[model samples]
Target: MPWRDRISELPECLITKILSYLPTKHSVKTSVLSTRWKNLWLTVPSLLLNCHDFPYRQDEVILSFLDRLLEFDPDSRLLKVKVECGGSEDIDGLRDRISTVIQRGPQHLDVESFTEYRDDDDDNFLYPFIDYIPLSLYTSRTLVSLTLTYSGLQDPGLVYMPCLKSMTLVKVHFLHAADLEKLVSGCPALEDLTLIRNMNPIYADEKVMRVRSRSLKRFRVPFSHGKRCRSSVKYTLEIDAPVLERMTLGEDHYDIIMVKNLTSLFTVDLGIKFVVEFGVFFYPGDLPKRNEIRYFLSGISSVKHMIISDKTVKAFELYSNVGMIPKFNNLSRLEAVFPFKLLQFLPAFLECCPNLKHLILEVYYSREMEDAFELTDVPQCFLSTLECVQLKRIHEWEEEEMKVATYFLENAAVLKKLTLSLTNYPRYVSDEEIFEEVNKVTKRSPACHILPDWGLCE
Candidate 1:
C-alpha cells in the first residue's frame, strides 16, 4: 500500500484527539483534507468559535458558519463548547443557534458577547433577551462544569444540574437571592463555585444576599460597587458545608458566624473589617464580654494554615475573655500582619499554638510612637518542633525583635533554619551583634541566615 493509504489507517480516536486542540474553524477545515477525514470533525468532542474566525462585514457570515457546523454533526455529544459573538445583528437567531448546539448535551458550555469598539448605546444592549438555557442543556447527566460570563441569567432557579462539579457566574444577575440559593442547593455534587458580581447595574440589599452549598469545597464571591452606591451592603452568610476544605471571604464588612461548622477545612483566609463606634459612656467597670475571642478561635479549630490581616487582631482580642485565648493545637503555618496588641498577646497566643512550625510575620510600622512593648523574658510556650522563621520589616532591631530572636534561639529545639529580613534601612543590627546573640543562646541549632533585602529574593 502507498504512504497515503497507510496514513488513512490511523484510529479515529487519535484523529479526534488531534482535532480537539485546534480552533473550531481549523477543526472544521479538516473535513476537506481527505475522504477519510471528511466526517472526522463531526466526532470531535469540543467546539470553540470566535467572531474573528469569520468576516464581520457581512451580518449573515456567522449565522452561515454556525448553520454549516451544526449541519455536519447535529447529534455530536460535545464535552465543551464556547461561542463568542462580536457584532450585533439578530440576537434571537443567535440564541436559537446556541440552543440547538447546547441541545446536543455538551458537558461544559460558555457563551459571551464582545465588541472591539465601545458603543454609546452599549448599556441598552446589556440585557440578554434570550428566554432560558433550554431544559435540555441542564438535564444532561454528564455535564460537570458550566460557566456563563456576561450573560443575562434572569432565572437561574429554573435550571438544575445534578452532576455539575464546578460553576462560575460572572456579571450575571438573578431575580432573587433565594433563586441563587436554590440553584446551589440543587447541585448535590458541586465542589467549587465562584460568583463574581462585577459591574452590574442592579443592586440588592444586605438581606437579599445569601449562599448555601452543602457539597461545596471552595466558594468566592466578590461584589463591585457602582458610583450610585457608595456604601457596601452587609449580609450574614450562613454556611453549612461540612466537607469544605478552603474558603475566602472577600472585602465585605459583615459579621462572620461560622457556627463551629466545617470540620474538614485546612486553609482559611479571612478579610475582617474593624470599626470604632461611640455610645453611652459607662463606668470603666462595665466592659464588653470576652466571648468574641472564643467565638473566632472556635470557628477555625480545624484549619492548619491561617492568613490574617493586621486590622482584625484588635477585634479578635476584644471579643475574647480577658485572659483566655483559643488553642490552635493543629496549627503548623501562620502568615499575619502583626499589630502592637497582637505582639503584646504573643506569649499567650503562642502558648495555644504548640505545633507551629513555620512563622511568617509582616510587621507594621508607624511614626506616631516608638516601640513601647518589649519582650523582657523568653516565652515558655516555644514550639519544640519549630523549624523556620521569616521575619519581615526589621525596623531598628527593637527590644521586641531582640527578645523574639533570643527566645527562638534559646527554645526551638528542632529549629533547623532562621531567616531574618531587614527592610527600609540598612544593617539595623550588625553581623557582630547577631553572632554575639547567637553565641549567648543557640548552642546546638542550625545556622541563622540574614537577608538584608528579602524582597529581592523573590
Candidate 2:
C-alpha cells in the first residue's frame, strides 16, 4: 500500500485540500489509486493541463480526461484554468474545453499552444504557430490575470476584459495595429502588460502602434534569440501611460519605441545586443547622430533606478558627439555591464547621474579597457553623494583599476561601502596583490566600510 493511503482516509474535504496542493495532473493521477480519490481534483479551485507533463499520451486520451474533469461540478466556485498544448492537436476539443472553462467565470485563464507550422510552400515565415482564440475571453468580467501565448491566425478582435489586472501575449498573431493597441486600451483595470512576439503584423498600412493607458504600471518587450532571424514588420511603438513605473525592453529591437507622459516611471532596464546594422532612422545606435538615441533616453529621464548593458554604453558613445546626456535628477541606483573597453566614458556618463548613491560595474576583462579609464576630473557623485560601489570580475590587479579605485577612495567625502569580487566561478577572490594595492590607497573617508570577504559578490 502507498504511504498516502492512511492520509487518504481523512474526510473528503481534507482529501480535496491535499489534492488542491498538487498540480492538476498529479491530482488527477490519484484517481487510479482508489475510488475515494476519483473525483477529489474536481473539488479543487484550479486546473492546469500541460501536454508536455504527460508525454506519449494521445490527444484523444487527453481530451477525454478533460471532458470528464471539466464536467459541470455544481459545488466548484471561482475556477482557474491553464492549458498548455500543441495548438493544432485536437483543435475542436481544445476549443470546446476552453469555452467550457470560460463559461464557468475563471478568475485566471492561461491558454498556450506550442503548435508549429514549417511548410515550404509558404516560405515567408519560419514559426507559424497559430490558434483561433475564442471571442468569449474578451468580455470576461471575473478574470484578474490573462496570458495567451502562441495564438495563431487569429484577429484578436476587440478585447474587453473589464476586470483583468495583468496580461501577457507571446507570439500571438494580430491582424491590425488597432487590434494590438486596443488590447491595452480595452483593459480598464490592467496594471501590467507583456508583449513578447508577433503581437504586431508582418506589414501594416500604418507604421505606428500606440498604447494609451492610465492604470498600467509595468511593461516588458522581450526578443527571442532563436526567433531573431524570422522576418517581421516594423513599427514605432508610442506608449502614453500616466502611472507606469517600470519598463523593460529585452534588446534595442529594430523598431522605434517612444514613451510619453510617463511621470511615475522609476525603473528602466535596456538589455544588450541590439542589431546595429539597421538604418539610422530606426536604430539609434546605428549612426553618430543623436536624434533617435536622445529621444529614447529623454522619455525615461525620470527613472530613479536603471540597469544598462554594454550595447547601450556603445550606443551612448555613438550619440555622445551631438548633445548632452539627459540628467537623471531622480536616479539613485545604477548597474552597468561593461562588455567592451568603454570604461573611459564612465566620467561623462556619471556627470549625468548627479544624485546617484549606489553604482555597480560588471566587467569582462579586455586589455584595452585598462588604458580606457581616463577621467578628466572627479565626478560630482565621487566628491559628495556616492556611497556604495560594487566591482565584479577583477581577475588581475591592473594599474587603471587601482587608479580608478584610489581616485574614488581619495575623493569621496560620504563614501559608505566598497565591495570587490573576482571574475571566475567557485568565485574565489584570493588575489593578495589586489588587496595589498587597494589597502595602500589613502582613506579620505574614515566612515567608509570596505567589504573584503571573498564570498561577497554582486
Candidate 3:
C-alpha cells in the first residue's frame, strides 16, 4: 500500500460520506483541515454526543453547539442521533434541546442517561437520573429505531408512530403496564423489541407486562443478575407474537413466562436460572415433575437451534429423570454447556432430540458427578441423524469421560466429524493414552474424522 494524500482530492460528497462515520466532535474538527472541508461538517448526517464533551452540567457549550447544528439547515434529515445524558440537572431543559434535534426527523434515536459522572479510567456508567423524553420524539413517523436507557423515564404520552420498526428500552421506567401497552399499540410496524432492565408498574392482579404485536418477529428479555426489584409482588413476562422467529432470555432467575405463540421460532439462546426451591442441601424430592413445572419447556420445544447453559440443563434434569421431556422433532443444532452436576443429563437430553444433527457439548469440570447417569443404549439420533459432534472442555485421565466419548465415536452410524478438545492438562495420564482409549471404540463409519486437539497440555 502506497501512502498518498490523493485521498483528499476525492469529491466532496464522498468525503462527507466518510466523515459521517466519525463522531460528531471529530466531524466538526475536520473543518480546520481545509477551506473545502470548513462547511462539510454541517452536512454530516449523524450527531453522536456524550455529556463528557462538555464540563458536567455546563449548558452553554451544549446549547451553543446544538443551536449551531440545528440552525445549519432546517431541512437537514438526520440519519442517526445518539446522546448520553450526564451531569444535567434541568431535566425539562435537556428534553427541549434533545427534542429540537429529534424533531428533525432522524431515522434512529439512542438516548442514554448516566446517573453518575465517571472518570476517564472507568468505562462503566452507573444509572442515576431519569430522563423525561419529549412526547414529539415518539410520534415521529420517520424514526425507524429507538433506544431509551433512562432510570426514571416518564411515559412520552400518546405515541402515534407508524414507521417505527425496532425499539429497545433499558432501565426506562413506566407508570403502568398500560403506558407500555399504549406505546406498543401505536407502533403498527414494529418488528423487533428488546427490554433490558425496564420497569413498568404491575398491578396486584396483573403482575407482568404484555406485548401482543402481530408484526413482531424478534423478542429479547435480557435481565442481568445485578438487577433487583424491591417490590414483593411477583411479575411474569407474557408475549403474544405469532410471527416471532428469534428469542433470548434470562441471565437471572425469572418469575414466570408465558410465550403465547412460537410457531415460527427458529433459534433461542438462554443464560437461564429457573426459580426452583432454594436450599443449602440437595434432595430428590426438591425436583418438580414435568406436570408440576410451569413448563417453559413446551414453548421453546419448536426451535431448530438452541444454546443453553449448565443451569438450564440442571433445571431440566428433574423432567428428564422421569422421561417427561417432550420430543424435539424440530430441533437440529444444539449446544449444551454443562457444569459438574449437569453432566449426567447430557445423554438423557440427547434421547429427547431425535433429529439433532450438530451437537456441541461444553463441560465445566468443576466437581464430581456423584450421581452420574449410566447409559444402556446409544441415542437414536446418534445412529441415524447426528452428523457432527464437538466435545469441548474434556479433562484428561477421566475414565467415565472417556467412556462417554467412546460411546458416541463408536456408535454414531452417520457421524462425519468428531472433535475432542482437552479442557486442561493431564492429571495422571498423557493425551496420547486418552487417544488410544478412544480409538478402541468401534468406528461405525470409516469416513468419520476423529480430531484430538490437546493444546491445553502443552
TM-score per prediction, in order, is 0.71, 0.86, 0.83
lDDT of 2 by residue, 1-458 (tens): 55555787788877876666567988878878778777677777778778766657577777787777766574455467788885454444677778778877999988887555655657675554356677777778789998888764345566788899998987666656677678788898999998765534443543576778989999888646433433356656788999999988875443666779989998988873434334222244345334556776888899999988776777675566556689998999999986547667787788899998999877656765434555457788777779999876666656656666776777766888877765455323357766766766635556777665475543
RMSD of each: 6.5, 3.8, 5.8
Number of the top TM-score candidate = 2
lDDT of 1: 0.63
- Model 2 spans > 4 angstroms off: 1-6, 52-57, 72-75, 87-90, 114-129, 152-158, 199-207, 226-232, 272-289, 368-373, 423-433, 444-447
Report the number of clashing residue pairs per model. 4, 2, 1
Q: Per lDDT, what order, best first? A: 3, 2, 1
User: What tens digits encode model 3's per-residue C-alpha lDDT throughout 237-275?
Assistant: 677788888888855433556777778889888765554
Q: List the residue pairs that clash in candidate 1.
A: 290-320, 292-319, 293-319, 293-320
**Compared with the true structure, what per-residue lDDT tens digits does model 1 show for residues 245-271?**
887754442323333467888887754
Worst 10-residue lDDT window for candidate 2 reads 273-282
Clashing pairs in 2: 130-152, 131-152
Global local distance difference test of model 2 = 0.72
**Cα TM-score of candidate 3:** 0.83
